[model samples]
Target: MISNNIKIKTQDLNVYYGEKQALFNVNLDIHSKEVTALIGPSGCGKSTFIRCINRMNDVIDICKIDGSIKIDDKEIIDNNVDVVRLRESIGMVFQKPNPFPKSIYDNISYGPSIHGLADNKSDMDKIVENSLKKAALWEEVKDRLDEPGTGLSGGQQQRLCIARAISVNPEVILMDEPCSALDPIATAKIEELIDELKKSYTIVIVTHSMSQAVRVSQRTGFFHLGKIIEVDTTEKIFKNPGNQMTQDYITGRFG
Candidate 1:
């Protein structure tokens, strides 16, 4: 069961890229220290919706957004919010593993160093070690900290990216189809990592795999054609969804 503690809240949220609108009236509450999954077909606004929470869409020249997404009771859509600092608080992991060309140790340390989260070299070392341990990659890459992050395998690279995202001690972690690029074994590892991560940080994942959603998320939201059809507990969303579209999608009638 999900706790009543809400870490993120969205109401009447909308997103547009030039003339094409991507989302419509998206209202959701993400519980603190819980995993919430966004499931939908390709281009159904799942990715767009998560981007709105952390203001990732602000980088695109054509993007425009309306409505409110609040974290810890503070509205993030307003101009007063410091986007760079807000991003440090809400870390993001992309669909593909995109680690910098730097060494593995530098990959994790860079964020903390830039954000001034570390006071010195020793603090940086501790942050890197802890982040890697949390991502379940410490033992595997501890000896190779000086090696290029890109030299890692697909799964390792993704995990390294996860370590980087958490190195700054973010409150929320947003994942967009994080396992789509990996093999089944790699996917399983990431899923297991996600399950463990929810104990410390609020996680919002956008995935196409319903089974993945069921495996990792406590809450599930079904999206379709630029709108959220329904949102509920993972079991309720999969086993007894209230909307016809949600039921059909879950039963594999159509994507």
Candidate 2:
């Protein structure tokens, strides 16, 4: 069951890529301390919608957005909105693990240092340790924090990215097909991490794997042709969907 602690809300949200409408009116409520899965075919607006939550869309020159998305009752799309602060409050992990070329320690501490979240070297070390621990990568990398982040395997690098994101202590974490580039074992590890991370952060994941969605999410939203067709409990979305498009996509009939 989803709690009443809504961390983010999207009302009549729409997106455009230089006159090409990518998302229609997308209304969504993401509860705090829960995992919500967005599932749809490629080119669907699932990824676009998640990017909007953290203001990543602002980077694309052709991308334009309308409607309201609120975080902690604050409008994120408003002109005076602090985009830097908004990004700090909402962290994102992309489909591929994009660790910096710097040392593993540097990767985790980068955000905290930039945001002035750490007071000193000791504080920075503590932040790195706690974030890596929370991301379940401490056991593997605790002995080699100085090594380049790319030295790790795909899964470890992804977790390192997660650690970096969490180091800022963001309120919400957006994952866009985080396991797509990982092997089965690596994917499983990430899935477990997602289940645990939900205890502290609101998670919104866009995944192509139905089983992954069913396993890790409390709620599911089905998208098709740039519109959300159904939003419900994970079980309901998989076992019984309200929309035919959702049902078809879930049953593997068609994307």
Each candidate structure's count of clashing pairs: 0, 0
lDDT of each residue in 1-255, candidate 1, tens digit only: 579999999999989999999999899999999999999889999999989988989999999999999899999999899999999999899999999999999999999988999888898999999999999999999998999999999999999999999999999999999999999999999999998899999999999899999999999999998998899999899888999999999889984
Clashing pairs in 1: none
Q: What is the lDDT of residue 218 in candidate 1?
A: 94
TM-score of model number 1: 0.98
lDDT assessment of candidate 2:
0.94
TM-score of each: 0.98, 0.98
Task: Give the runs in model 2 whose Cα sits over 4 Å from its true position.
Answer: none
